[model samples]
Target: MRRPRPIAPAAGQESVWDYPRPPRVEPVTERVTIRLGGDLIADTRRAVRVLETSHPPVYYLPIADFVRGALVEADGASFCEFKGAARYFDVRNGGTVRRGAAWNYPNPTPGFEALTDRIAVYAASMDECTVGDEIATPQPGGFYGGWVTSSVVGPFKGDPGSLGW
Candidate 1:
């Protein structure tokens, strides 16, 4: 199978190809906002982003930034090779409820300690999600929580026929 070439990044853009294979965690100073249903549930400048090759960055917001009682543990869990066990959360705002809308690693694996207890929401599960001034488009598949922005270029993973990437 022929490998897809990544798009060339413009002057201010970044190619996901340059992101590392094991992923890297870095602090993001840009504002991150999340709205569920019709309510603003999270707004924070203190966030971390995990970047990996062929995938958009997944932003993790500190749980302290969420509204009181806005999140409740939902009944499902998953495991990641790098991040360890992840627990799901249902976000409740006003009268709207989005089940399994967010996830977090309670105890991340050795190199991913920055992810512990920080929540990463699925942008598709929210009414709106933004990073800095740009609204984020959810990564192509439902299973991966990556936020795609104009500054990033991709032949991104998670789209149909991209699993082999």
Candidate 2:
């Protein structure tokens, strides 16, 4: 399939088109915070991001940063060709419970071992998710966990009609 035209990024922004295939994982210097149902569930400065071509970055936070009882292992699993098997989590805070809203790879592929102790949540599942001081928008579609911020531009992969992208 022909690739979609990429949106040109501004001076301080990155085009998702420029991200690599097989994805690249790197540390994020900004603070990551997640709030759901009026409770702070996860907060951490030491986070990692996985960037893939045509996709916004997927941020992963250390499991130790989550509040106690905030993440309950849900009954579901999925396999990622690059990251290995992932298990789901039910995120809870106050009266809210988002089932399968987060996931972690207990035993990741070789290059992705850094994710073994990390969890990635769907931004839309939380009332608020921020990177640094900027609020993150969830990437289109329910399947991807990419977080869209001012730093990245896209003709992203999960948009409608992008199934073959």
Error of 1 at 10 (Å): 0.4
Best prediction by TM-score: 2
Please list the residue runs of candidate 1 whose C-alpha ends up more than 4 Å from where it truly belongs after superposition: none
TM-score of 2: 0.98
The global Cα lDDT (0 to 1) of model 1 is 0.92
User: CA shift at 49, candidate 2, in angstroms?
Assistant: 0.4
Least accurate 10 contiguous residues by lDDT in model 2:
109-118
Per-model TM values vs. the true structure: 0.96, 0.98
Local distance difference test scores for all models:
0.92, 0.94
lDDT of 2: 0.94
* Residue-by-residue lDDT tens digits, candidate 2, 74-141: 99999999999999999998789999999999999989988879999999999999999999999998
lDDT of 1 by residue, 27-95 (tens): 998999999868789999999999998899999999999999889999999998777899999998988
Off by over 4 Å in 2: none
Evaluated at residue 53, the lDDT of candidate 2 is: 95
